[model samples]
Target: MRRAYSVETVRAAEAALMQRLPEGELMRRAAAGLAVACGDLLRRNGRVYGSRVLLLVGSGDNGGDALYAGARLARRGAGVRALLLAPDRAHPGGLAALLAAGGQVVDGPDGLGVLDLVVDGITGIGGRGGLREDATGLLHTVTRDRTPVLSVDLPSGVEADTGEVHGDAVRADATVTFGTYKPGLLIDPAAEHAGALRLVDIGLGPELPEPPDLEALQYADVAALLPAPGPESDKYRRGVVGVVAGSERYPGAAVLAVAGALHGGAGAVRYVGPGADAVIARYPEALVHAGPPSEAGRVQAWVVGPGLGDGRGAEAAVADVLAADVPVLVDADGLRLLDAETVRTRTAPTVLTPHAGEAAALLGTAREEVEAGRLAAVRELAARYRATVLLKGSTTLVAEARDTPVRVNPTGTSWLATAGSGDVLSGLTGSLLAAGLAPRDAASVGAYLHGLAARHGSDGAPVSAQDVAEGIRAAWRDVRAG
Candidate 1:
């Protein structure tokens, strides 16, 4: 697991580490790592001898890191210029060092010549809301050209703890983070701006909190979490997932849901809905039940509502599944039928998977609000519904109602916005729940696999729902291989 600390936690850890180190040692380590990365970029661009590098300097230690890095690059033959946004507030030691090494300060870059790369040091962990006026103007100047930018610490103006962009934030070509990752670097609104991330170890020890406040599971972590069939395992012993979805109007949903469940490592899929004929036509292996959810029979877990209508029938179906006292995944229209009180009253674990629109409806807020602050929205949904909520989008967030840490899924691709994708995810997650993974694990693992499958199915082209389902086995193998 890759842990992300809250800004307060990072500051606390940094303060503790600072006490043990020699004067300026931590800053030196950060500056040295940053200078090396800049050197690599220069080498790749074929201009290590005399490339033009511009640094946007601010008031905090973030600016200190950038100035020292500029000094190193200047000594190494790179023409470095530092744009001081807060001239009076600039790091005095850093400025003097850079000047001694042949670096000059510009008030702010206005009509300045294009540089090969721009480094953002406008804000760090202590910043809140948007960029300062001077910083925002400087960022606009760089955006006028194709000059690639590397953000120091994090992209300026983003909420370090929640990944929320308050106003204008710098969009970087890459971000160089010090010590451990901040929550903003891994979650979205901020994550969309922070292009690629490179961590520079500043030697902050494990005295930082355990189990992390937030995490993004890397391939190895996910690989370890996946269930492997034992020598004594049989089909029945693996697990069975029961699905209640579809109506006569949207029969294809039931078929697609069953298709996804079949590939989700579940031994069997029991379907209960009016679309049994359609499901049987597409996937004959499913055990179809045309009757009610109560009589559909035993299952380790249940998935309710993909294309379920907004009538009494949908509500009744969801109530029946909730009554089953098994792990349940509710998605799409099913999300609309949920009652907060009913969900809280349930004895079994419940998982809610809602896209921005669905989540907006559930929270009685505008969709834009939910998209702008995904972490807050997901947490609110989890608390209100008393369930594990998966807020799906570019960065999928899994938040549990209980005290467990939230896990942000970072493997998103634009191609995943295709129709019927949610149904597939619902099926896959429900199957994982049935296979005995906890609600949070089921949602996170399902999201990881869903994104990987999209990448495999798209191969840089358009892909349909069936293609995503068909690509699951390959995705499973690829994850396992990792």
Candidate 2:
């Protein structure tokens, strides 16, 4: 698992580590890593010796890292220049070191003629809101030529804890983070601003605490969590998933949801809705029913609300599914009918999958607010409903009601923004729940597989929901192979 610590935690860890090391030793270690990363980028263009490097120095340690790194490049024969945003506030020691190494300080933007690369050290993790007007204007002028940018620690102007980008922010071609990943570098909105991420260990692991603020699962982690059949395993032993979806108006949703469930690790899929005939046509293996979910017979888990439109029957169906003692997943139209008290009172584990719009309605806020602050929105929903919440979008986040690390999915692609795609995810996660995985694990694993499947199905082209379901087997194979 890839762990991300909050700014407070990282600061504490850095402080603790700095105490044990000699004076300026910690900063030297960080500068060494930054210099190597800068050299690598310069090498790709030609060589570091003749590269024109520019540093955006601010009034913080981040600026110190940049200044020291500039000195390293200068000693290596690179023409390095520092554009100090705050001359008086700049790291005095670092500025002196850069000048001693033959690096010059440019008075203003006009002196920044041409550059091979730009190092963004305008703000650190502690800086919030966005870039100041002066920094923003200077950044705009520098980036007008489309010079590749390398942001130190993280892209300035993005919240390190919440991944929210307010006002003006630096968009970097790549970000060189230290010690560990930040929540802003992993989550979206802010994540999008960070093109590529590179982590440099400054040996803060021993100082940091267990159970980081956020985590992202890798291939090996997902492989171990995946379910496989044994020689003595039977259909019932594997698990059965019940899907209650689709209305007369949206029968295709039922078929798509069943498609995802069939591909999931479930032994059998039992579907109950008005779209029974359509599901039967697509998948004869699914057990179909036309009445309420109560009459749908035995199921280890239930997935409700894919295409059930607004109606009296739909409401009753959602209520009936919630009453079941099995693990339940609620999505789409079902999200609209959920009662916070009812969900909180459930004895069985409940998972809520909502997009930004749906999540906003549940939280009584605007969609834009949820989109801006996804980490907060997802955590709030999980706490309020007392259930596992999956906030789906550019980055799929799974948060448990308890104080555990939130899982951020890294495999998501833009191709997943299609009709019925979310319905497929709902059914897939529901199947995992039936397979006896905990709500949080099921949600995380489901998102991982869902994203990989979408990539396989799309493969640089447009893909339908059915194509994504078909790609599940391939995704499973790939994960196992690794």
Give the best candidate by TM-score.
Answer: 2
Q: Write model 2 residue lDDT over 1-482, tens digit each, in one string.
A: 88999999999999999999998888888899999999998898889998999999998799999999999999999999999998999999899999999999988879667789999999978788999998999998988889999999999999999899998899999899999999999998999988888889899999989999999999999999998889988777788999999988899889988898889878999999989889998899999987689897889999999999996699899999999999999999999987778899999999999999999999999999999999999999999999999999999999999999999999999889999999899889988998889999999999999999999998888988988998888999999998
lDDT of 1 at 13: 88
Q: What is the RMSD of candidate 1?
A: 1.4
User: Which regions in candidate 2 have their CA more than 4 angstroms from the true location?
Assistant: none
Error of 2 at 193 (Å): 1.2
TM-score of each: 0.97, 0.98
Query: What do the candidate models score in CA lDDT, each in turn?
Result: 0.87, 0.92
lDDT of 1 by residue, 1-482 (tens): 77898888888888899899898888999999999888887788787668989999889799999999999999998888999888899999889989999998886676568788898888877789998776777788776777888889899899899999988899988888999899999888899899888889999856588868899987887787777678987766777899999987777788778888888888899999988888888888899887578798889999998999875588889888888878989998888887778888888999999999999999999999999889889999999999999999999999998877899996777888888888888898888888888888889998999889888988889988878887778889999988
- Pairs of residues at least 3 apart in sequence or in different chains that clash in candidate 2: none
